[model samples]
Target: MPDTGRSERGAVSAARTRDFARFRHEALLLKALGISKPLIACMAQRAAVTGTSIETEVLASGAIDEEAYYGGLARMAGLPFVAEIPDGMINDGPALDCQLKEPTLVRLHCNGRAPVIALVPKITHIEGLASRVKRSACLGETIVITTPSAIRRAVWKAGGERRGRVAVHGLFQATQPLSARTVVTGDQGFSAGLLISGLLMLLALAPQLLMIILHLILSLFHLGGLMLRLAVLAHTRRHGSEHETMLQSADMALPIYSVMVAIYREAAVVPQLIAALDEIDWPRSRLDIKLVCEADDLETLAAIAKVRPGPHFEVVEVPAMQPRTKPKALTYALAGARGEFITIYDAEDRPHPQQLREAYHRFRLSSDKLACLQSPLVIANGGESWLSAVFALEYAALFRRLLPALGFYRMPLPLGGTSNHFRTAALTGCGG
Candidate 1:
């Protein structure tokens, strides 16, 4: 209460100083390994941008003093310094079980090259290392090595030959270059209008264009049908008092609700899923949340058990079946559900607190024909990369704009994979 704002600013400044010092120390260690200053600068910038700390420890055989290297890096980067060498280094015996426990931004500099690995979580297992390396490849990071055995193994695994004499350090490189062709195309409204106008002009000029005109008219009629459906949906949403009354009646009945989450090999995402469910604003007593897992997925089962959720949290083991996909698993879970209403959420989804309430309101207001109310599903980590950004934008356009427009017109919804709230009776009747 006493100047809290000033204290917060001071804390932030101290954190930044610590970050700068860490970067400098790591850079000096890399220099001792024969990594260039320019490369170190690039790595430092990458690390700074990603908000990750750098650490380097010398092996027992190495002559380089860890403290001196750390200090040199800090001095070069123009930041405050601190260093502590752990008992183990990368070359330590039998690769000790070091956990990369935090979501880290790693900038690797070997020789004169720099590579960046973003949003890498603390890895606990040796098996996870290969997957991490593969993911880094997907992100287009350069791999460089100052150590001979490390480079040899990496090169061999990568199917690259060691050129010339056996050197202590070597570099592997890749980058995700920005491509103009990869950008999503904008709306083609003008071109479509021009095409329609030209067709009309042609029909006006040709008196014997009756057959072509008839075909065009038929096409227009089909389009009009689609438009009419949209119009009906819009009208229903805006003016259907009867619909609202029906939903209200349903709410008055106060039926129980169940939420199903269909998962495959999603052990990594289960923690987040449970966390999201825990944050749901609905009454916990009435909430029956199911974690539908495949029979063979031991990892997911283990992860679920680790959480040790309450009775409301049910772990449903799906039998091995053909077409082992989410929809199939959900179909199986739906058969056993005892709730009046059912909803689906994905492993990575972070649904809004009031989502269930909004869906209930929609149901209570509408007739049975409005069996499903699909809440918009958005990418929570959309800005992580260009691919994710585009994926997020596409979803936003579909769920927020296009789907609503379609619903307004009473057209059949293409049905998104998640956030679909359903009346159990209506869904069962429709063979859902």
Candidate 2:
């Protein structure tokens, strides 16, 4: 009690020593394993520049062999190393019953009573999970190191075994939808077909009268819709305001933000997408960026790999299925999102850096009913073409005017495909 300050100082000093010791230990292990000093220095430099773990950067940047890294990790952890995980080594019961493939950062080996985990060396919370997995699985966890690709294969296999081949299918399929929900329904198609058939029959029976009445009704409906849209635009132009003052301070702790980007054949835009994500104001640690790609889109996937996104980014490969739309890709990506808030961006989107912060603050200040935030969409190349200019104007009216008016009136919002931030729970509750 008399020397509490001295004790605290000593504890801090010891913690620093332990941290340095781990670094030195890894370096010595690499050297002892015959890794070159220059390569070791390169790993350290890349880790420093990318804000990723030394082990991960070394592996990703090709400075170290994957097998060597795993072996070295096993030695450092004092655990047995396996060059290859055997077939059925992970018991289907425990693996299927648990979320082994999720988070895309950890892989679970369920062969024994104890769970073996291959986790990202830097990002994984070994201390916190030690008790949790043991309590949940009724087995102690054995931690190891593995690359992201290894875990992806494990997850895909486990899911297929557990949920059938459709487990890997994106949320939408023509044969069977994911749940009670569907992005498009047969009922809608049937109804549309019925309406067209009835209209044709009417035209055949009494063309003159039916055409006149149909035109009148359609014209009125169109006029009313345009008037309502104009009204919203007028209101927006008069009172639209930014939540500039509501922005949080930079010192405030940032919550995890999930960003979903779906790319099919967009190889050329992959670099731009990465650049746009990097430009976000939020810390990389707090940004969970999922680049959703189709399994068959090898070109786009290759482009993404060439970009070499940092630890914050993940590549979610959606198994090819019917109704191959962006929403389908997003639905697949949604299953693995780990964040408090989620948002979407297109292949060419370049949202403001402060967008995430503003959205977070707006949600905090808003009522519980306010579950989503729509960012304004602006076209940067409107001057280049007449069609582009028209598209730009339409977007301006839709995002700025109509959406704001709809929000103000508490009316149902027709959500735009991208830049719409949502509360994660709310989205998942509605079968994201």
Candidate 3:
């Protein structure tokens, strides 16, 4: 047999050589386009430090906006540059969603010609594309270049209705038992009704005995809840949190972290909400913030448009549907989430600036069984009323202390509605 070890070594060597050749090829092209040697060297260093590509470092650093860089790419390849890809020019399909992730190609029909729109698949391919364009004028006419954002926008618009359907029904359809859509299953409802009716009939016949039995059952349930709380309390006091320091800092290349905010008629707080989102400390290029608003809430949409959040932020308008709740709004927007991990926040919550960083760090350290990290939600208006104060205390005892203990002790952990981070794959696997 052939020497397997030698073959593997040869493959590794060949891969390194190709990487070197591509790096040199891209560097020479950038130099030809008037990029100074010093600037290139700076970006190259930044790329190494972050464990990212020169292209990623360049775009994220704001050295060159997508328009200028992709336009330059179009020019070099002798292809036309499209400022925007019209929704009407493209066709939507089930597989069209693949473009939302990588955005390599989108075929367009314009003026009776099918011109193929593309983003540069790789820097090394530009020379080959330019060569092909020179060899065939027809190929040049058939090809065009555009930014990734343009392609995503076109896909979002084309699939708006479909996305809405998926967002609304995805969870319920995938896993009915997990969905809150139905209050209870038919069998569960029947059992509950039968139990309640039997207890009432027994009370009518033997009031004293029924009362004693009822007291015993209720007391047992109460004691169980009490024990669960105390166990968590004791665990917390003894060990403290494993994430007190927010784990180690993530200097390496970070995956896209998506932040989703579902708002209803809270137009008055739009400015504050946008400001809070802007304060999160993360790379702009890797942050995907989705502001999910109801379709009928024109005021909130108008307010967001007026504020004009960055390109990293996008508005996902969910169609007005039944059970018009925050969770439903969040569920609807999940279809369009483009991130490795995602989190939900309310309109008024000003999350800690380092919250995303901490969440990512914890996820890296934890095992796959760890599906989510629920950030403690503290109530701000506790001092306003006695009722509010009690609620705030409940939140503190449950989230800040109890839940962490429950997880540490391998007990059942219930998640809150907002301020929880989840791995996208795990979330989708559990039907979102």
Q: Is 1 or 3 the stronger prediction by lDDT? A: 3
Cα-based TM-score, every candidate: 0.44, 0.68, 0.83
Candidate 1 runs further than 4 Å off: 1-253
List the pairs of residues colliding in candidate 2: none
Q: What is the lDDT of residue 15 in candidate 2?
A: 63
The local distance difference test score of each candidate is: 0.57, 0.69, 0.80
The lDDT, on a scale of 0 to 1, for candidate 2 is 0.69
Query: Residues 1-432, candidate 2, lDDT per residue (tens digit)?
Result: 489999999987886565445556556656665678887666755444444445555655555566666666545444445555544544444334233223234445564456666554432333344445546653223655565445555564455333323333423343355543565588988999999998899899989989898899999999999999888767767886544585755522566789999898999999989998988887554578889888889999999999988766878877776657776677666666778899999999988888898899888888887778888889999999999999999888788777778878888888888899999989867656
Report the error of model 2 at residue 223, Å.
2.0
Query: For candidate 3, lDDT tens digit of each residue in 194-254?
Result: 9999989998999999989989999999999899778877887799866556655545558
Best-to-worst order by lDDT is 3, 2, 1
Which residue runs of candidate 2 sit more than 4 Å off their true CA positions? 1-73, 81-153, 160-208, 237-243
Candidate 3: stretches off by over 4 Å: 1-42, 118-124, 207-216, 240-244, 319-323, 381-388
